[model samples]
Target: MRLALVTGASRGIGRATALKLAQQGYRVAVNYRKRAQEAQQVVAAIREQGGDAFAVQADIADEAQVMALFQRLDEEDKPLGVLVNNAGILFTQCRVEDLSAERLQRVFATNVTGAFLCCREAVKRMATQHGGLGGAIINVSSAASRLGAPGEYVDYAASKGAMDALTKGLSLEVAAQGIRVNSVRPGFIYTEMHADGGEPGRVDRVAAMAGAIPMGRGGEAEEIAEAIVWLASEAASYVTGTFIDAAGGR
Candidate 1:
């Protein structure tokens, strides 16, 4: 089976996708920045179910750390066929006037720049010209990219917009190289990420508001995972540079 690397695999969509990919027979590399314990648990759970997995650590925001991450995967002696760029960061609610340069830099560094580095590395390994067998890259964007996350998370929205552009540009670049690139945009998903926004119940709060979500409910991490896995699977072999909005009709 080919190996699939999932960044931020300690929890949320990343963890769910890691488990799902393992179920599909891919040896999973659960990458975590500081959540070693949770990452290990994911690996343990996969092993318990007769699936293969291992935990790897890296702070995607740092270029050195990102390089070390792919190097670690290189040591595994397995062909890397799938990469899930799921690691991202978001700060608490703040208006545009209150946004700090440091905050914007940090968010873009992780969500955009870091993802670029990961794709670069993955391409080096998965591109046919590089002697690789080719593969798929699934970037986890957000619905905020389209909705603009108006009052809050504007910076995050912009970063995801960049991710969308990256997915399109990179897909075309590697299309003939036997690689496919795509993205999944999830909206109001119930995950630990909401706590990062200083609102642990943000999803519920928004979904409760009149007409906030068309489906009248927040989405789940597993639902987003399914879209991501499909994009990385053979079923989407001919699909590239596309986005799956798994956002409950929002």
Candidate 2:
């Protein structure tokens, strides 16, 4: 069975992507940092649907943890066929000038460094000629990178911008090895990250702020999941170093 390793698989886009990949016949390794129970629930749901899945915990920001996570996957006898670098954290709401060095480091640690660590490991395993078919790395980015996310969370936007750069550069470097690298930049999706920001109603606030979007509403996690699954599948064999925007016409 093809195996997929998805970080932050406990909720939102990450959880939705895990379930979607399982539905597409990929045995999924659901990676979570602290939400063990929620991760298990995702695994259980996939298993109940007759799909192969298991939960693995790791903080993607830590190099040792990321290495160990991949080592564990190797031990499972499932060389990774796909990787989704979805684990990330947003900084507390504050202006750019008010952003502390600590907050900046925390966001980049998970958003940029974490994705790079996982991508590096995935590339090592997938680029090998003996590791079944070559794999793909899909980084989950944000449209805020372009929107500039002023006033609210520019730090988060900058972190995702780094992810975009990683997507482009890494794709070119690894294209010859049959490992495709790409990114999916989603606009204002309803997720728990915003809930933790204390405004569980962020989607509505976003819609109010960006009123010009043609789609007229925020996106759903399932919507982004479908895009992610397609990019990882053979349907996008010719696509690499591309950014699939899941924004509702923003």
How many clashes does each candidate structure show, in the order listed?
A: 0, 0
Q: Whose lDDT is greatest here? A: 1
RMSD of 1: 0.7
What is the C-alpha lDDT profile of model 2 across 53-102, one tens digit per residue?
99999998899999999998988776689999999898567899898999
| TM-score between model 2 and native | 0.97
Off-target runs (Cα >4 Å) in candidate 1 are none
What's the lDDT for residue 231 in model 1? 95
Model 1, C-alpha of 220: deviation from truth (Å): 0.7
Cα lDDT for residue 177, model 2? 88
lDDT of 1 by residue, 80-159 (tens): 99999999999998888899999999999999999999999999999999999999999999999999998889999999
User: Runs in model 2 with CA error above 4 Å?
Assistant: 129-132
Highest-TM-score candidate: 1
Q: Which ten residues in a row have the lowest lDDT in candidate 2?
A: 205-214
